[model samples]
Target: MTSVSLVAPGDAPLTLPVAAAPAPARVPTARRYLMCEPRHFAVEYRINPWMDPEQPVDVELAVRQWRELKGVYEALGHRVDVVEPAPGLPDMVFAANSGTVVGGRVLGSRFRAPQRAPEAEHFRRWFEANGYPGVVMPERINEAEGDFTWTGRYLLAGTGFRTDPAAHAEAQEALGVPVVSLRLVDPRYYHLDTALFVLAEDLVAYYPQAFSPGSREVLAGLFPDAVLADERDAACLGLNAVSDGRNVVLPLEARGLAAEVERRGFTAVPVDISELRKSGGGPKCCTLEIRD
Candidate 1:
C-alpha cells in the first residue's frame, strides 16, 4: 500500500503537555483514536445550518482548539493518529465521519454530500496503510462514525438525514453485529452523533426531540437508564461526546449534560472546541475511536 502523508508541513506534532487525570475505578479507558489537524479547515460551504459560507472562520484558533482536544486524549493515555488533510477537503477535519471501526475491520462511508465524498477514500486508504486491511466499502449511502456507533456489543445506527436506512443491513453484515436503526427527524441533528451518544455498554445520553416517536421508543427500550439532555445543552451540541467507560469528554457549553454525566459516576472533562462547532461538529465529531 502507498503511504500518504496525513499531516501538513507546518502542522504541530501530536505531542503536547500532558495533564493526566486519574482514571475512575472500574471504567475502561479508550486506547486509540484517529484525528486530523485543522490545518486547512474553513467554512467554505453551507452544508448544514451551522455553516455559513458568508462568514469567516478563525483558522489559527481552530488548529489550537483541535490540538487541545487531541491533548485531552493523550493525557488520558490514549494513542492518537492522524490522517493527512487534503487541501480542498476542509471537512476532513471532522474525522469521525470517515468510517466506523469494529474488531479491526473498517466499513468505509459512502457520503451523502458531494463535498465530503472524497474523504471516504482518504479514510479508507489511511486505515489500509495503517494495518487495518479489512476495509469494506458499503454499497449503500452511509456516513460512518457520524451515523454509526457501537454499544460494546451491538451497533447503533442513525439515518433519515445523511445515511440511508438500507446501510443498516450492510453494517450488520460488515461488522457481524446486530444493528439497531434509529431515525433522525430534525435536520439540525443531521447525524446520529449530534443527537445520541453511547457513554457505555448500557448507558447513553441523547436529546429525545431529535428522533421520531418510534425511534425514541426504540432507544428507551434499549437504554432504560438513558441520560436525557435538556434543550439548552442539546442546542449547544452537548450530546456529541466521547466516553471511555469512565470519563466523558464533552463541550464546556453543555453544563446541564455535564452535570448529568457526573451524576452517573463518570468524570466529565470539558474541552472548548467552539471554533470547530462553526462547521457543525463538536468533540465526538473530531475524534474517531479505533476499537481495533
Candidate 2:
C-alpha cells in the first residue's frame, strides 16, 4: 500500500508544544474508512435496510465489512479503534461520538435518545480500556454525543433533535467548558454534524438551512472564513466532511463540495458509506479518533 501525502500549498507543518504529545499528524490521505459490523436498531424504524430492520442483518457479512474497513485503515498505517458491539442498543456500536477527548481527558457522553442509551455502557468500557481520566455524564439532562463540538477553549452543544435544552446547560456547567447551544429543528438534520462541521481552527463548512440565526452567528463569530455547502450536496451529507489537518473524507456523491475542499488546499477523498447512511450515519459516525 502506497501512502499519499496530504500536504498542500501554504499549509504549515504541525508541531506539538509539549514533548509527551499524541501523534501530531493530521488525517492521513491514505486512510479512508467506514463501519460495517453495526448493531441493528429496533424494528420500529426498520424502513431503511441500513438501519434497524424487521430482520437481523447477516452477522458474517457484517464481520466481513468490518474487516474490510479495518484492512483499509491498517493498510494506510492508521490504527483502528474498535469498540465491542453492545446488545440491545443497536446504534451503540457507532462509536465515534461516545465521548470527546480534550486536554487528554475523555468525557463519556450521555445520549439524549433512549434507543441509544446502551451506548454509555459500550463507551464506558472503551474509555476504561484506553485509560482516560475524569469521565463525566449529566445527571438529569439528556445530551447526545453528536451535540458537542469542542475547540481548545470552547465546547458548543446543539439543542433540539435528540439532545435537549437542559443538557446543553448542564454540559457548560458541569464540564467547565464554555458551551454555546445551537438549535436544530429540521427532522432530516438530526445532529449538528449533519449540517455543520469545523474544518479547521478558522474554517468550517455548513448549510444555513439547518442552523438557527443564533447558531449561524455563533459559527460566524468563531470561524470567520466558514463556507456554505450547496443545498443539493448538503442533502447528500456534504457538510459532514472530516479533516485531520491534511485531507478530508467526503461523501462520494458530493463532487462539487469535494472540489471546494480541494480548492481550500485540502485533499478530498470521496468514500462510499451508503450502508452506514441507511442507518442514519456517515464516516464521522463510524470511528472515534482517540487523540492520545
Candidate 3:
C-alpha cells in the first residue's frame, strides 16, 4: 500500500486521529411582544387611583421612556410589534389593557370605567385587521391582560377592582382555558398585573397585602415557592414585571424584587418607566405578549 502524506511535500508528515465535529449550538426561540407608543399619553382622566388629572405629565419624557423600554426588548432578541396610538386615547400606551392574546385568539377587553371605554373599539379593530385566528368581544367587564395573565397552565383572573367577577366565566369560554379568579382588595393593586406576576413555569412573585386572605391562600397553594415582594418594592410596582423565563423586565426602583429574581436564576433587567407609572403602568403594562 502507498503511504499517503498528511502534510505538504518536503514538510514533516504526521499521523493524527480524526475528530468528530461538535454539534451546532441550539438557539432559543425569541419571544414576540406588542407595544404602543406613548404619543398622546397623559393623565387626562382619573380611572385608577394612580392616575390624577391634576398631576401634570411630561408628555415628551413619557415618550422617551416608552421608546427606551421598546429598545430593551429588541436588544434581548425579542420581536416587538407596534399598534397605532389613537389621538384622544391617553391610556392607549398601556397596551396590556387592550386584550389577552392566547393560542392565536384575542379576547378583547370591555372597560369598567367609561374613561377607557373608547379604547376597546380601537383594540378590537386592530386585532380584526391583523387577521387573528379569532377575536371574541367580552360581554362582561374585563381589563384584558391588566386583570388576566397565563401561567402556562391556567389563566389567573383578578376581580373586585377593574375586572368583574362575571368576566371570569367569559374569559374561560372565549380563550378556551381554565380561569382562576383572584380577588384584589387593595386599591393600589387594582390590576392583577400590579400585584402578581408569573415568572416561569410554576413560579410566581407577588405581594400578599394586595390580595384578600382567601386569594392569598389560593396563591400560596398554587405557588409555594413564590417570591414574596417587600412592601417597599411592591409599592413601587415591583410585581408588575414581564418575564420571558430567563429574563425579567421590571422597574428600576424595584431593587428588592430584582435581587429575589436573581437568586432564582433569572437575569433582572431594570427599565425606568416612572413617567408611565404616573398613569398607573410599568414595564408589564406597556407590553402585551403575543402567544400566537
Top of the candidates by lDDT: 1
Q: Tens digit of lDDT per residue, candidate 2, span 1-292?
A: 2233455589965543444433233443333222325644333454222355555445445445445555545654666766666566666546655766555556667765566666776676666766664666656445344667665467767766766777767676655678778888666677777777766655678887788888888878887777778888878876665665556767789888888777676777677665556566666666555544
| Ten contiguous residues with the weakest lDDT in model 3 | 20-29
Error of 1 at 241 (Å): 0.4
lDDT on C-alpha atoms for all candidate structures: 0.90, 0.63, 0.89
**Better structure of 1 and 3 per lDDT:** 1
TM-scores of all candidate predictions against the true structure: 0.90, 0.76, 0.89
Point out the higher-scoring one by lDDT: 1 or 2.
1
Off by over 4 Å in 1: 1-26
For candidate 1, the TM-score is 0.90
For residue 110, model 3's alpha carbon misses the true position, in angstroms, by 0.4
Candidate No. with top TM-score: 1
Superposed model 3: Cα runs more than 4 Å off: 1-29
Candidate 3, position 73, lDDT? 94
